[model samples]
Target: MPSLVDYIIYTFIKIDDSLNKILEEYDRPLRARVFKPKLSDSEVITMELIGELFGIDSTVGIWRYFNKHWT
Candidate 1:
């Protein structure tokens, strides 16, 4: 069946993208993996961007959570 989406898709498919050039970016280190589905450096920074996203900022509070979950 004919549709607007099909029309747009076909138009872009005929366009040439060979003229475009892109630069490479630096690779992220493995130690930055902190959450499920693990994220990149920019993503990891965003995760902690929100104030108190982890809650209870101090070291003691963090240690308490670690102790409860670890031993």
Candidate 2:
């Protein structure tokens, strides 16, 4: 069996793929400004999901957790 981390990663990948597909089918502008962001929408969403899964309440806590584990 795959480890818990592996399962989490797999689920995240599936969710991201689905999100991308939906976005592609839409006509709405994804970004608010002309300038592009460093991180993709899917990446930001994955981080948000991680924050929720880990019970992080604040944006700062989410950043800290992501930086600690991802960076």
TM-score list, all predictions: 0.25, 0.75
lDDT of 1 by residue, 1-71 (tens): 75744643443333212111211232543354456553333332322332134575755665465457535
Residue-level lDDT tens digits of model 2 in 1-71: 99867866886798789888888887985778778898877777777787877899888899898889778
What C-alpha lDDT values do all the predictions have? 0.40, 0.81
Residue 56 C-alpha lDDT in model 2:
99
Where model 2 places Cα greater than 4 Å from the true spot, the runs are: none
- The number of the candidate with the highest TM-score is 2
Q: Model 2 lDDT vs. the true structure?
A: 0.81
